[model samples]
Target chain A: MTDIIVGILAFLGTIFVFLAAVGMVRMPDTYLRISVTTKAATLGIGLLLIAGAIYSNELAITAKILAIILFLLLTAPVSAHLIGRTSYFSGVKLWKNSVMDDMEGKYDTSSEELRSGFETDPEKSKPTKSSG
Target chain B: MVDRIIALDLIITTGIGFISAYSILYDQPALLDVAMILALIAFLGTVAFTYYIQQKNKQ
Candidate 1:
């Protein structure tokens, strides 16, 4: 029974990882590629780790697997966000067919700040001027 | 250029980590350590690359 569970999990994990690779190749732009791969790869590895933990059934191995899963889950989003932000700031263009860019005109290139799109009054959102 | 390179590096590192998970099937648990370290390196690498890009843009 345990063997069957492990096989199923490992199979699913492999499939997701494979799909992540395909998405990385097929996605239209850098941002789209990053978004797809990060989520898919993270989940794939996490499931694989869980399967390993179950198969091993050792205290040390299971704990290590848990730690790895936690680390992957926590870091994947952060890395994806960093990559996307850097790509955007460095002027990587969006796909031609992209309908709407929520980040459009929101980034202040001079100060490297992003103004809030939700705020109606732009001046009210600014930090108080430092000095004259 | 940098974006594509970094994204590709991330995916490849992830693939390597996934492969290391296979050690468990063969009853070699030590390789899990490799997977753990790879995860750390991938995150640090992304952070460093992003910082480099940001600084480059600031100049």
Candidate 2:
């Protein structure tokens, strides 16, 4: 029974990781690649770790596996965010077919700051300020 | 722009994860430590690469 469960988990984990790899290649832009790969890879890693823990059937190994899973879960998002931010700052262009860019013109490259969409238009804010 | 859409570190990390699981199934627990360290280094490597890219573009 344990073997069956472990095999199932390992298979599922492999499938997810494989999907991440495929997405990485198929995605058109850097941001899209990062977004797809990070979530899938992280989940795959967690599943693989869980399977390993079950297969080992040792308390110490299981604890270590859990720790690894926890660490990966915490850092995956942070690293992905860092990569995407850096790519944007480095002027990686978006997909040509991308419809709307929420961050367009909202990022102040000079100061390395990101402003809200509403805050980006001084003209829009000026009318409200004058009315108030 | 990088030639590849995805970063190399992500692929390496996934491979290490798979290897670690295989190691456990094969009755070699020691390899798990190595896999964990490799994964850690892969993540740090990605962060460092991004920082480098950011600094390069800052100019």
Candidate 3:
């Protein structure tokens, strides 16, 4: 019974990991690719680790598996975020059909700064300032 | 740019995990140790890459 469960989990994990790789290849832009790969890979690896722990049934092995899973969970998203931010800053263009770019006018590529909406329009703030 | 690198890292880590699990299934204890070391290497590689990206972006 335990063997059957472990095999099933491992199989599913491999499938998910494969899907993530396919997504990475098919995605149009770096941002979309990162988003797809990160989510799928994290879940796949988590499942795989769980399977390992279940199959081993040994305290030390299970503990190590849990530690790896915890490390992966905590770091995966953060690394993805950092990579995405760096890519955006580095001017990796978005997909052509991408409809809404929240960072469209807010981010300055040259300076690597993100400006508030109010800061982008001088006219909006002119009225509030009094000439001395 | 860095997104691709990170994605590649993730794929490699997943492969390592699979290999580790395969070792356990085969009753090869030494291979399990290798898997643990690989996992640690992967984690450290990610951290280093993140730091490199930050440094590159700042300049």
Among the numbered candidates, top DockQ falls to 1
DockQ winner, 1 or 3: 1
Ordered by lDDT, highest first, the candidates read 1, 2, 3
Of candidate 3 chain A, the 10-residue stretch with the lowest lDDT total is A123-132
Candidate 1 is graded, for docking, as: medium
What lDDT tens digits, residue by residue, belong to model 2 across residues A30-82?
88888888888888888888888888999998888887888888888888888
Error of 1 at A58 (Å): 1.0
Better of 1 and 2 by DockQ: 1
Interface RMSD score of each model? 1.8, 2.0, 2.2
Q: What is the TM-score of chain B alone in each candidate?
A: 0.72, 0.73, 0.71
lDDT of 2 at A39: 89
Give the per-residue lDDT of model 1 (tens digit) for A59-126.
99899889988988888888888888788878888888988787777676667677666677878465
What digit string (tens of lDDT, one per residue) describes model 3 on residues A56-118?
A: 888988887777777778877877777777677666788888887676666655555556566
How far is A16's C-alpha from truth in model 3 (Å)? 0.6
* Candidate 1 local lDDT, residue A118: 67
Cα lDDT tens digits, model 2, B1-59, are: 44242467666768777677778667887788877887788778777788777778777
Cα lDDT tens digits for candidate 1, B1-59: 65565566556566555655667657899888888887888888888878988888889
What is the TM-score of chain A, computed separately for every candidate? 0.84, 0.83, 0.87
